[model samples]
Target: MEELIYFHDHALVILTLITIIVFYGLISIITNTFTNRFLLESHHIETIWTVIPAIILIFLALPSLRLLYIMDELNDPHLTIKAIGHQWYWSYEYTDYQDLEFDSYMVPTQDLNPGQPRLLEVDNRLVAPTHSPVRVLTTSADVLHSWAIPALGLKMDAVPGRLNQLSFLTPRSGVFYGQCSEICGANHSFMPIVLESVPLNVFEDWASSLME
Candidate 1:
């Protein structure tokens, strides 16, 4: 199901372009016909034409709603992490690991390695285990910020006083990047997010080290 959603993301881009082209062609045809004919005005033709975008919407809404519900439905999570957004940095707490916490700040572009992506790498990344259900609790310390990761299909607003919950299970190990989607301050663009998913054994080892 995850793979299907990932594929749909790309498919949606193509579908969107096709939809735009078809709509454009239809409008052009209508305009050309009305312009060439002096007796019929475009407004007269418009009265007979009713766009039932609802039909297209119905098809698009089903899969999207299904995915939304699935993402929100909480199962027995193997781990839980709390993320708090501050002025220009992020703090993470592992609730299941004795509430161990740490701060994750963005690495400056000048200090990045040759293969590292500018403005996307961070000093400390939120780490988790692959193929494990992890629940995330998000909140803000001061202003509103959004935690978004496109690959995981996760995005939730971090409100100052409210806690928002989200969950995901990464099928593979890799580093996923995101940023402060909402404009919160002067350095909003500099507040990047990086998540590293490792093997279960590696995660357990890392968690143990954090405890020490």
Candidate 2:
């Protein structure tokens, strides 16, 4: 996510520079002394058009390549979680722990508690620790579905018989939400993905309580 933010900020700066340069060129052309032939053709015009664009292209490509590299770089994960999408729900497995697995069903709007988000609440939320490297594996049991979280900048396809993986880290404790991006079935709209991040001690306590 930091890489994405950097790319976005760099793009804004480049856009501002381009805008200023264009306005300056337009004003200079208007204020300059020009004959009919000077307006038609100039030794500087052709060279400027070609050379300036090449330089701009190189500048744009540098950041684009950097972003791609950042996206593909995979680091050693401290925890691994596997998520399998069902017809209208999701199942999760904590592979790093003692066979901890559960199904997460979306909470019905009628059953939602006060201050709870409608259609976004789930019966079970995947919980992890903050400031830790976490890897997520995705697959589908039936139809196609997409596991995505916009805030974390993660979007992976859940294809049948194939596994896709993505790694992310949350520096702070918060609840993140997402939904099935693919058209699965009639109840697709009801299915949502919820994740909770807490301190390492809190997460350990929560995991231990499940066994008790």
Which 10 consecutive residues of model 2 have the lowest summed lDDT?
A: 31-40
Score every model by TM-score.
0.77, 0.89
TM-score of model 1 relative to the true fold?
Answer: 0.77
Please name the candidate that would achieve the greatest lDDT relative to the true structure.
Answer: 2
The digit string of per-residue lDDT tens for model 2 on 9-49 reads 88888889999988997887798734468745987888988
Which candidate ranks first by TM-score, i.e. highest? 2
Model 1 lDDT, full chain set = 0.87
Tens digits of per-residue lDDT, candidate 1, 47-106, equal 544344554566667777776788888889999999999999999999887858999998
Q: What are the lDDT scores of the predictions, listed in order?
A: 0.87, 0.89
- Clash list (residue pairs), candidate 2: none
